[model samples]
Target: MLYTNITSINHFFITGFPGLSLEHYGIVSCLLLVLFLAIVFGNMFLLVFVKCESSLHRPTYLIFCHLALTDLTFGTVTLPKIISKYWFDDSIISFYGCFAQMYFIHLIGAAHSFILMVMALDRSIAIYAPLRYTVLFTNTSASVLCVISWLLPTSWMVGVVLDALSLPYCNSNIIVQCYCDHIAITSLGCENVRDVHIVAFGLAMFSLLVPLGFIIISYFIIIVAVMRISSAQSRIKTLSTCTPQLLITFLYYMPRCFVYLANNVGFTFSVPVRIVVVMLYSLLPAAVNPIIYCFKTKAIKDSLKRKFLVRKVNIRTKT
Candidate 1:
């Protein structure tokens, strides 16, 4: 997959959590396997519940369903390869495969940011101006936003991936990451890749901060609106609806911002520590999203109760 005359590395060795002890490998592998299953089933339950329960057909739930789908895709893209690396001792990934993995990871990262932003906006409008919320966050509008989240990244991210892919990689092919990532792959470039790094950092900031800015502003306004409610119970009830999304937003953005800033500012950390931080932010949020949704939203909880409890009762009565 060499696009130029220069000698490009054809394969890379993915170091799964650098500095990991050989004895601890089995423990880490088991944890990752459990995480993958959690992500798969948790999100699948959210998807199916949202689809089957007619009462959960509001725009907010629709957007939440899409977010669950995104999390499923995110886990699939970055988790299995690393799980295989630890469990089966398979670490070699082809150049194009590595490139493709890096591309989708960033693409999904960007899309996840926007989807969270949309979720924030949906809540902000609902709380800030209750009368206008339905008009603004219609089913059609939410669908459109979800489509844009997936499509918008496709255009700019191609250049990001191709830029790194075009660079001449030196002899070393060991990427100090669980899977192929832009920073890990670009650092192997033989020539000065400072400019490419700059472009990537800039895009990364835009993708993360722009949506984050909107989210922050939205929540600020929501706070103001919540405070104005005279009844203490009403205020609590209103803010509670938003707590799940706020928690998810924190999980996704805080570590990302901290890591990117730390790298640029020369704040040093061990390779294992950094990769753990990356995994926590990227994968942990997706795994936790379903739990948050099921527990926080009354609609989802009620739906779960109705489906499972009724089934149990029906089985007992038939027996």
Candidate 2:
């Protein structure tokens, strides 16, 4: 699967959460199993609910549906391999598999970042200009944005994956991190990769930070508009819609920014700690997104309640 003659290492060995002992693998695997199941099923529930409930067909929920699908794909790309690594002691990944995983990992990361920005934009428009929000965030428009969100990241990562693949890998093929991340893979290059690292860092910043900046700006404008509302109740009601988004955004971005800072800025942290930080940002949001939407959005809550009540009534009638 070597696309180039430069790749001497034909495979990679991923050490899941370095510094943990043998016995700890079982515990860690069990925890990750729970997380993987939660991420998969939680996002699936969101997808099904969004699809089944016609009332939840607005731009906000549509964007969330897209987000749910992205989270599911993201977790699928990164988690199951690690779960296998810990559960079955399977750590070797083919070189092409490594490249493929790295590509999707970053691709999905970039996609979700853009999707969050889209969500923020949807919120800002809905609140700041409710009259035109419908016109602005129509289903067609949101679908187009969703397509762009998915494509842009794949396009961005094409060069990245090519660059990494072209690099000579005569050095050790051991990826110290949990998965075949760009940083973890590139660090094993046989030659000096200063320029490559520079480009990689630039791409990473563009993927994660640019959308993050947009989200921050969108929230800032949203806050100002919310404040201008004269009634306390009005302001509270308007602001409450944004609280869940802000919380989820924080949950998603803060750990990512921390990881970037720790990696590039020379902030000292143990390997296990860094891996934990990565997992926290990547998986936690996927697991919590459904809960956030269900609790925060009344429509989803009422729909779930109605379904439960109907099921109860059906059971009682049968009995």
Candidate 3:
């Protein structure tokens, strides 16, 4: 038994996402598998394309590569457990297992938020200082920024995990979500988690809300700057470059905001609604990221075409 009364439920049944039925597991599994592949392969392709294309060796794309890596890590941290839930019917994670999941989820999530902020900063510098962009965002500076982005989140997550673990879960041990989310797990505690809630909320604001605010402000400034440019063609080109990023930002930020709001306000949706929200939050960004890159950037599309054509030619030659 994982919990004694005032809790007494050891291992609660986690129904995959929020509303997914056992009868629909096969369909959900197929959809999720497709999404998983797209997220993983898409990010990998972006990373490789950036590396192999000499023309793409700039500060902007460098940050994008890092962003892709972070997205890949973030998706990997959450989706595997979701897949397992559908495949194995095993939703019961142990106490320690739950803690570990929370740690990595928060870590990658914070890293994702930080990377978005960095990307916004990169854009700000690029738009504001075209001539000095290279000098301002050198490889060394970018590398340092990336390290800080990763380390800060790592430290915060470690603290959260430690604090959560220290709390006595003397009541129930069942996590509501398919995976062990910190907010969901903390809510199950029998003891007062006021301090824990405060800390978690603080971190969420710092990691998610702050970065989101920065991105919005950065884009606002960017739009103003772009509008002031007298050349219509140049303005169009600038807007085009920013559009893909804006789409990504919208998709990433809105669902996260919903989830955080839901957690904070004690907004209780039905199981299906909750599952949809969580699934969208976890999966959509990963799925959309690659598609955005592939469609928005000609360089990636051309490279993929070349690789596919080369493979086709080789197959014909062999036959």
Candidate 1: pairs in clash? none
List model 2 lDDT by residue over 83-185, tens digit each: 9999999999998999999999888888888989998998899888989988888988887898899999787699999998888888687888888899899
lDDT of 2: 0.87
Per-residue lDDT of candidate 3, residues 171-243 (tens digit): 7665667677787888877789999989987997899888888998888888888888999999988778776
Poorest 10 consecutive residues of model 2 by lDDT? 1-10
Query: Which stretches of candidate 2 lie above 4 Å from their native place?
Result: 1-7, 262-266
Q: State TM-scores per candidate.
A: 0.94, 0.94, 0.88
Clashes of each: 0, 0, 4
lDDT of 3: 0.78
What TM-score, to 2 decimals, does candidate 3 have? 0.88
Instruction: Compare candidates 1 and 2 on lDDT and give the better one.
Output: 1
The ten-residue window of minimal lDDT in model 1 covers: 1-10
lDDT per residue, candidate 1, 1-319, as tens digits? 1223447667888988877888888899999999999999999999998988899989889888888988999899998999888888898899899999999999999998999999998999999999987887899999899889889988999999989977888657888899898999999888899999999989988999999999999999999999999999999999999888888888888888888789779997787887888898889888999999999887888888898999999999999
